[model samples]
Every structure is written in C-alpha cells, then in structure tokens.
Target: MKRHASFLGLCCLLIVAALLGGCASLPAPRPVPPTYAIQDVASTRLARIAKQNALPGAAELSGFRLLPEAPFSFNARIALASRAEKSIDAQYYELRNDGVGRQLLRELRDASLRGVRVRLLVDDLYMSDADELFSSLAAYPNVEVRLFNPLPARSGSLLSRIVFSIHEFGRINHRMHNKLFIVDNSFSVSGGRNIADEYFMQDGQANFIDMDVLASGPVVREQSAAFDIYWNSEQVRPIGQVASFDLSPEQAQRRFDQWVGGAGHGLPENERDALGRTSVAHQLDDGKLDQFHAKAQVLVDDPAKIMRGRMEERFQGSVSQRTLAVLETARSHLFITSPYYVPGQVGLAQIQRQLQGGVKIIVVTNSLAATDEPLVYAGYARYRKEILKLGVVIYELSPMLSQRSGRLGEFGKTTGRLHGKTAVIDDKRVFVGSMNLDGRSASLNTEIGLVIDSPEIAADINRIISIDRYTSAYLVRIGATGGVEWVEQDSSGTTTAVHEDEPETSWFIKSKNWLLSPFVAEELL
Candidate 1:
C-alpha cells in the first residue's frame, strides 16, 4: 500500500508540472531588419540680426569676412597631454566606409571608459539593429548614445507602416538624419559616414563612398556644442536607459568578443573595433591644434519652440539658417553632393530660381545602381527632367563605388559611390555634415554643418567634387538641342553615353520604380 501511494503522488506531480509548463509563455524575440540606406532656402532679414548678435567667431566665417592666412592662434591638444593651441590643418583625415570607421568606434569606446565625456549622435535610421555591440561601450558610466527621431517599427508591411503613424509605426520614415561624434570638446569626426560596416568599408570590403572630417581646432568646440544640443534634446535616449537592455560590462564584453570573433553576431565587427580604439589615452593634449587655420561657425538646425501668438511648435531653424545662407550667397557656382536627392515641387522651384539667378549648379547624387534606398530614387525620378530643364546638372554614382577602394589594388574593380553631403559656393565657402538636399532634411530632420570660409579649403573641396563629378559620376545632360543623355566615361579612358529615352533601363528596374513610386513613402528613404 505504501508503494502504491508513492507512485500515485509522483504521477500527480508530473501532471501538475506539465500543466504549469503549458500555461507559461515564452518571451518574445527581438526584431531585426535588413540594412538600407536635407535642404534650404530663405531671405536675409534674420541675417542682420544674427550678424549683429552672433557668437564670437560667427561673423568672420558667415559672410566673406576674409581672414588672411597669417599666424592666428587656434586651440589644439594631443592625447591627454600638453596645452591648447590653434589647429592650422587644412587637410583632415578622410575616413570612409569600414577601414577607418571601425577604428573610430573603438576609439570612442575607449575614450568613454577613461572618464572622457563621449557623445554619439546618429541618424535613427542607422540604429535599427538591436544586436549592435554598443552595450560594452554603453557600460561605461560617462558614455551616452542617442538616436535622432527614433521610432521603432513593428512590421515590414506597407499596410503596417500606413497604419503606424510616425508616432506608433514600426517604420519611422522621417528620421533624424545627422551623424556626429564629439569627444572631450576637442576632437570630432563628422560627415556622411555612419557607424556601419559599409560606410567603414568593413562590409565585405565593399567601399562605401563616404567622407569624414577630423577637426581639432576651436571648430571642435563649435561642433561639440551642436552635439550637446542634440544629445540633451528629447529625440535622443541614453543607451543605458533603453528598456529591456540591462547588461554589465563582463556580460557585454563577452557578447562583444563573440561578435568580433564571428560567433554569428550580426553587427559589423569593424565598427566595434573602431569604438574600442578611441581610448582616453588617445585624448588630445593641448597645443596640438596650433597648426589649424581659419575660424569656423557651427550651423545647426535643431527643432526648437516657435511661438506665433498662442501657438508653439518646433521649427527646423538650422535648416533655414544654413540653407538660406548658402542659396543666397551662391554666386558663380554651386556644387552639391548628396547620397539621396528628393526635391518636391517647392524644392524644385527653389533650385530653378537659383539657376535663374545665373549660378552654375552641379549636383551629384546616387543612381539606381548605386543607391541603397530605391524608394528615394523613385521620388527623385519625378523631378529629374524638371531639374534638368531648370539648368541644374545631375549625376548619379555607380554601385561599383560601393566596392572597397584601394583594398584590392589597381586591377580590382572600383565602384564610385557618393556618400557625402557638401556644398561649395563660388569656391569661397564649404558646408559639410549630415544634412542632405532633400525635403525631409529641410523640414523633418535635425541637421548640423560647418560653414567654413577659407578660400584654400573651398578650393580643395571643389577639386574633390569636380574629380568625382567628371570621373566617378554620370552627367545628366540636356543640350540646347533638347537632347537628353546619361553620359559616362568608358572604363578604358573613353567616353560612352546612353539615353534614358531609349528604354536603356532594364525592365526589372522599370517595374521596381513603378511599384515604389506611388507610395510616396518619403519617410523610409
């Protein structure tokens, strides 16, 4: 009888255990999405107010206040040693894609660990991957990470997107489109490069055409200040504060190592590596920037409260300030290089007006072959002919630029992609930063750039753009005879051209463009 009782008890326990297991719910898995891939105008009324009441170094750089290249003191520092001096360097490090991007990220991570204040402001679109190796860096107490206009997407379907507003939808199409990294208010790296494998050329050695400017002068301070505004803004969230993510350094380190070791972790390994190298040991000591020349003014378009008699809302003032300055100041020539080009009717009209003013405007953006975001290209196509009619020249990059440059030597194929947003006016001034020449850039996203007034610097930027224009870019030409052609140079140092009117685009592309055009889903691109 005792043996019988024991067996019955055991069976009842097993049944209860099974029932409990059935009732328990498993945790949901994190979502991962596929990799994918701004503007201005205005008048001069505010210019006088800004000029009269601007920051210390604002005026000289804003409007043709030419500073002769004589010995002027600029702040500089070396890695954790020395005194402050001017940074006279005209040529800064140009890091594109993965090769240098990984190094940069590593450097950022190290800088934070050593008690050096670090700030990372990325356009929210680039931070979709929850699996990125940020926790290790985020583990550092002084480090902060914020996403611009980050709205998490829940589903990839179009219906899901439409049903989901920018407020609730999983896909946030209108994003914060600026990329900035400021360390210790002394050194910075800004440009088209995002913290990704492709931008750093670490993604299969695919050379993503990108640009970065490493600045150390007073400009660094200016850049950092703008970064601080975005850092403290509502759009950003500290990495540590992100819910559902609570990991200590030891745990994060293990995860990072697994990621770096190819344990099937999804992040681009080199970006993590870059984060590792930005140690506090690399902090610039003062006296290092003595060589940098020219003063700089930081132009930022942050959303700020605008009150109009009992109404208050955020305005993209930075966009208005910077773009209006550039458009109004453009004299003989205008050079624009943006990866994404979407000019709606108003935007197109603005360019036309600029053209009517007799400015030679040349624009270089991504082609269907080179662009990662096809939907953006669909929107761009709507304005291509109209833009050409208004005397604006357009060029699209080839996907080959997406392949790593110089990694495989001269014999390897070169894909010339344009991943930089810059503007040069009459070889007198240059603007470089995260903003693009698009509607979203003008009204939706927060953007930042440097308005540099050094003739030598402008010349260098102009040369770079011109080289890319004639060599790496395709020329969309409409002659006086009304002939439209997509002209390109041959690989063998020859010239060959194709006309868009000739049905040159493959049927596949035509169908894809057709399908994506109607959606007007400007947010995703």
Candidate 2:
C-alpha cells in the first residue's frame, strides 16, 4: 500500500507539472505606453513651499524631514496624495490589500476623482489573489495599476506558481525592491517601508521600528526619474495585460468603497483627521514647512540591473555598491542601522580597514528573538565574534521592549524588530534609504537611498537614535571564553543582566540554527 501511495503521489506531481508547463507560460512582453513624470511644477504649492524654507543660500538644493513615527509617516503619504494637484507616482515592492493598504488605495481613488493622475507600480512576487482589486483600481478614470516582475501563474499556491514558472526561475527570482512616492513631481517620500498594517503599527501581532524621509526640492526630480525608469521598464505590465477583470467602472467604485469606505477597520472622521497630515498641509499652506536643508544626492539601482548577467550586475550602478563606496570615505565614526546585516567577506574587509584607520563603527541590529527573519540571524552570528574583536560596537534590540508601548510602538504579543536602514558618517553626512547591508540587498534586489551632506541633520538623527546612549538594546560583546554575550542595560545605561546566549532565543530555535547555520551563505541571506 505504501508503494502504491508513493507511485500515486509521483503520478499526480507529474500530471500537475505537465498541465502547468502547458498553460502557465507568461505572455510576451507587450509595448508599454511610455509615461514620464511632469516636471513643470515650479509654480505648484509644494515647490513654492519647499523653496521658501530651503537652506539659506542653498535654496536650489533639496530639503528633507525625518519621519520616525508610524502614524505620521503613514499619514504623510495620504496627506501628499490628498494635496496632489496634477500627478501622483507611487511605487513600492509590496502593497497588500489589508486595512491600511485599502485605505491608501481609497485615498488614491479620491485623488483621481479630483482629476489627479495616479500610477501605482507594485511587485508581483507576493501578489496572489489580488487581480480583482488591482483590476478594479485600474478601471477608475484617472488611475493606472502596473505590476513589476509579474509572474505567469497568477492564481495558485506560491509553491505552484514557482513550480509552474520554473523555466523562468532566474528572471522571476530577481525583484525590484525600490520604494518611492511623489506628488506633482515636487514632494516625495522614500525608505524601507511598504503599504501594510504592520508597518503602520496597526498590527497587534508584531511591528517594525522603521524610518522614512520626506524629501522636497531638487532631489525629488532625481527620485521621479528613478520611478519613471521602473514604470516604463519591460519588467512592468499593465494590470489588464496580466489578469482578466470583469468589473465595470461603476462596479469598481463599489468594490473600492466596500473595501475601505465605512466598515470595520474604517477610519472615523476624527481618527481620519488625526491620521491625515493636516498639520503638514497647514505648514505647506503657510509656507513654513519644517525640514532640514541639505545638499542631497539620490542613488537608484538601474532597472536593467536585474536583467543583466552576473558579471554585468556588479557594474550596474547598484545603490548598495554606491553606498558602500560612500562608507569607505568615513573619516571618524560610522553608525549603521540595518535589521538583516549579513556583512559578507567583502564588507568585513572594509570594516577591518576602517577600524585599522582609527574609525569607530557602531551597528544596531535585531536580536534573534526580535527579528522577523530568524534564519537571517544565523548568517550574522557567524561573524559576531570577529566583528566584536575588531573594536566595533553592536546593539541588538531586546524582546523586553515590547512590554511597553513607546516610540517603537506596541508590539503587543510579539517583539519589536528593527527595519530602518541608514548610516551616519562623522556626524556630517547621512545615508538613508531601503538598502540593507545584507547579501540580498547587494545584488539580488534593487534599492534606492539618499546621501545628504548636512551636519545638523546627522547630529539630530544621531541624538534621537543610533548612539542615543539610553536605548532598549543589548550591548553585544565577546565573553572571556570568546563566546558571545548580550549585556542588558538599564535606563541609565548600566548593565543589569548578562545573557550567555542570545537573549530570549528559544532552545528549539537554537538547535535549529545549529543545524542550519552551516548551510547558510552570507551573500544569500
């Protein structure tokens, strides 16, 4: 009977493979109607407000504001969309159909209703069972939805999709991980965030401590250029080209209304007002936008990076590669905040050189217990001792942090994880964006970031985070036996408890790590 069952299973698998191979082939890339960002916005409200408050003689430069709060960051995008006069170009790696995601779509719908052109480009890797919503969104008069790196098998299990599209594995594996939002080609926002409940601190199960920058002025033009590249890339496809939609325009409006318009999880008038960027809009209205004035340079991975061969990828002007080049110029101190920091041999060599040159390096990352990607921690653990021996300071966020609802937000039953990616150099420059120090960010995925030359902004960011002294993170150190130890500190920055193992890490997970760490490669994590 066991033999019969095995044979039957094999037969079923073969049958499914044959069926999928026959029907799941992706359609050939169709000609995408080219669209470019509108650049004649010098007279627009955002452009005028941004210029009014630009750095004294640096009015021609860009301006930026750090958004560390979840509620404010979420609302800032909404506010910009609400105030959008001409066009809104929003791009992200992932945009779920959850509560907050739906609300954001609703805002876009409203913006379109007011005659604003809307273009939403989202990655298709995790977009399963969302054809109806996106197709419906595209049905609106002024809205267009496109997918980045879309898959052939749209409606099936993730495993089935991968299996059916195995022939194109190399292409499908590469993804566009850039995130940006622009209004009227003037005001923009970018960082390591996607449209989801967890990112906004609304997910009671768990949440990430993240950061975003609200950018305006000259640098926004560069950002819009990056968006235009991906929007018109061959990897992107109009929603109608990938999936079939039966919803009429009227039906589309009804569908959107049902999803976000007055229901459970719907924002009440008062709450919506609180969530909206009325204050930001008011500041713009008054031409008194509070932001740091800085000369900023934008870096974006060329959209064609994913389509190139291995050797060609290394020279694709990738954001991670360029960011590393900037880090090499660090004179005194380098403060890095990345959650999944699996610095491979190349990165370690860079760190060694920096330390030998008398540069101080500090890293803030997630502990095994607090991280959403537990397996990724295994890659970091392999280099923890070596990193500590090189005189680098390390801090791992503690799980105890979730007990209270503070700046990191209420993780509730789960732990707060670090998701922000930024680095400060000599307290005079700041690099903020979606690029992580991990292997995947280096080559597998595309990313974007900003390099700002402004001591005031760097100092302010450092004072609030990274090296604030008072933090809910454990000081990682090498023990006398050369093993790792996590020193838990008090509010006054005194060591109150010492953990011989990864604090709050379960024994089962430890065993799993022991088995899996050896097989894990630094670059892949």
Candidate 3:
C-alpha cells in the first residue's frame, strides 16, 4: 500500500507542475503589424507643408513640454493676454477630479441638455471604464460618441465564441489614440490627456498625466473639420451598437440616467468624476477670453483615406514633411515634448542639421522609469547616442519627481504624468495636440495640432513648462568615452549616473522587442 501511494503522489506532482508551466509559457502578445510605408524625400517634404498655411501661421515654430521639466505655461500666457477680448475662455486643471475630467464631463452634459452638439474623441488605449459613460453620453440628442477601435467581443453563448474567433482575430491590437474634445466648433481641447483615470491621476498610484491646450480661434474651425473627418471615418464606430452580448437602449438609458443624476459625485475607484465641474470652471468666470488676432494654423493627418493612392505617400512622411519645414523656418530655438521618442535615422538627420545650424534644440521625453511602454523605450534608447551627439539638449523626465522639486516643479501629491505633445520654435509658433515623435504618430494613428503665432503665448509656455521643470528631469549627457550617462541631481545636491540592475533589461522584455520589431514599425507608433 505504501509503494502504491508513493507512486500516485509523484504522478500528481508532475501533473500539477505541467499545468502551471503551461500557463506560464503562454506566448507574449504579438506586436501590431507594420503600418508606415517609406516615401520619397520630395513627397515627404510636400506632405509636411500640405497643412502649412492652411490656416495661416499654422506652421509656426513649436517646442515640447516634457515632465519633470515644464508645466504648461502657454495657457497661462494666453490667460495673461490683454488684447481685444475675443470671448475666448481659458482654464487649467490637473489630472485629478479637481481639474479637467470633471470639468469636461460637466460641459458635455450641459451641452447635451441645451441641445448644443457635443463630440468627443479619445485614444482607445485608455478606455478602461469609459464604455458605459460613452454609451450614456450618446443617448442625448445633441451628443454623438464614437470609439476609435473597440475590443473584440466574446460571444454570449459558448458556441458563439467559436463562431466569431475565426473571423475576428485581427481587430485586437490597432487602436485610436487621438485625444480631442470639441465644443460647438468654437472651442477644442487637444493634447495627451485621454478620458481615463490615470490621465486624470485619479488612479492614486500612478500619476497619469497629460496636457491639453484649449483653443478658440479660426483654429477651432479646423479642429471641428478634423473631428468630423474622424467621426465619419470607418476607423471609428458608434458604441453599444455592436451586435452580441448585453448592451441595450434601455441599459444605455439607465447608465445615462445614473451618470446625469449623480453627475460629479460617484465614480469607480479608478475613474474621475468628469461631470461635477461647471462650464469653464478652471478659467476666470465672466472674464474676457483670449483672442488670436495673430496668425494661427492647423494641421490634420490620418491614414483612413490613402491620399495620392500610394501607401508610401501616406502617414509615414506626414510629420517629417511638416516638422522639417517648421525647423527650417525656426530662428533662435526649438522645443519638443513627446511621450514616446523614436526619431529614425532620416528624421534624426534633419534635427541634427537644425542643431548644427545654431538652432537651440531642446527635447523633453520620459525616462525609462517614467515610460509606460518599455519596448518603445528600447527603440528610442538606441537613438539617444546619435541625437545627443548633434549638440541637442535633451531632458528625460525623472520618475515620481514633482514640478517644484527642481526644474519640472512640484507635482500634485498623487497626480503626475507628462502626456503632452508640443513643439515651439523661436517664440513665433507653437504646436500642441496628440502627435508623438514615433512611427505610430507619423503614419499609423491619426493626429491633429494647431500652430499659434503668438510670441507672448510661446514665451509663457517656455517659462511655465521648460525653464522651471527641466531641472528635475534627467539631462542626457555624453562622456568622453562615448558612453552616454543619464545625469540627475539628488536631494544632497549630488549628481549620479543611473544604470539598471540587470545590466540586461529583462529577457522577457528583450524577447518582446525582438519579436515585435519587424511588425512594430515606428510610423504606426
């Protein structure tokens, strides 16, 4: 009996081990497919200027506002403008419920009730619990909400899952990450902030940050046109309308009722109360809004319709065409703030040329500790050496550092994440919206921005964001040995070089990059 029992015990242990091992061995997700096509140099240049002068001065020079580096000062500068009152209201809010999200939700609800048309665009990556909120928002007569790309549905019945799996496998990875909120075509909010708790810093753990610049001018008209294009495009679709599972009009109505009735009050643990704030809460009430009597421009790009019919002529060359032009026109300095930084050989060349020509090129991006996507960082890391070599000043945001701690400034105790995409050049122009300096923003994802030609606004942006905050960010410096060191000053006033423990980034992460590199082309970043 003892011998038989021992054999059975051994067999059970082996079975358990196999089961756990199999679970652990599940393959990492496959990367999204290549989405950018290489284009001819000439064609690339044309596309850059395609949106140039579209709204006059839209091609102004622009710079970036990287975290642990700068707070958005452009908004404040506009707030300070004393020009002819154009009735342009301005507001600044943090990521927590105290600022943007709640304010946006309230405006949306009020607009709906008053029958003013409301349209919202959000990057699908952050749509964790927004589905219900969106569905509710869609119920109003003046409101129409669409999702960029939605998750594949699991069929209600066991048989249904099997039925749909064969046909629906490709819809999982690609998503719409464009973030824009347009109000009646007179005002719009565009930047890095998405409709999510992290973007709002309501998550408590991670300071999900991002910046959005609210603008009203002839530029808002362009933003409206851009929003209409995406809304009507096939890349986005109305929510809850997908056939399957459980969403019903009644259910949607119930959600709407709860959201509107309890507006501004209750939200899930990970969500912000977007509905509590009133109209333009952050800005001065009844104060005269800023006017953009100066030249302003707008640029919009997307992959939905392949203009010129050649895949190569599409999104891959979009930003380069425009950005290169902006650089060439820049006089004194240029600022760049992108969450993901992966300027390929060709793109980096232009930037290098600009730096050598005596243009003050400054870049603010996330450090490894602050970067949410490590693989993207892996690709960006490879270019650091080449970029810094060109004499461009680079600042990588430090993890958990506040804006006040150093140059970046003090961050809200629980809210801090730099999610702004901006560029300013020579105080003559500024670009702010949802485009990153990666392949994705270039070709795969649709993006939009405004080029403001107000030197006053530009100076304000530089002061609040660039000058004050960059001190806390890791300054990228090269040593004589060609070894690049991430330099940062600690509380003791000592500078140190940061290196990882593994000396090898985790094998798991490397393997992911290796497998995804082929398909994870930069244009679609």
Candidate lDDT scores, in order, read 0.48, 0.78, 0.50
Model 3: per-residue Cα lDDT over 81-154, one tens digit each: 21111111211111122333544455555545654445554433334345666666666665555555443432
Q: Best by TM-score, which number?
A: 2
Full candidate order by TM-score, most accurate first: 2, 3, 1
Instruction: Give the better candidate number (1 or 2) by TM-score.
Output: 2
Specify the poorest-scoring 10-residue window by lDDT in model 1.
67-76
The global Cα lDDT (0 to 1) of model 1 is: 0.48
Positional deviation of 317 in candidate 2, in angstroms?
Answer: 2.5
Model 2 ranges off by over 4 Å: 1-23, 157-160, 263-279, 467-470
TM-score of candidate 3 on Cα atoms, chains taken together: 0.68
Tell me the tens digit of each residue's lDDT in model 2 across 336-375. 9998888888789999999999999999988998887666
Instruction: List where candidate 3 sits over 4 angstroms from the true fold.
Output: 1-107, 121-133, 154-174, 243-251, 259-284, 290-293, 303-311, 316-320, 403-416, 489-525
What digit string (tens of lDDT, one per residue) describes model 1 on residues 307-356? 11111122335563456557558878888878778866556767877788
Range of the 10 consecutive residues with the lowest summed lDDT in candidate 3: 1-10
Q: What is the TM-score of each candidate against the true structure?
A: 0.67, 0.91, 0.68
Per-prediction RMSD in angstroms?
14.8, 5.5, 12.8
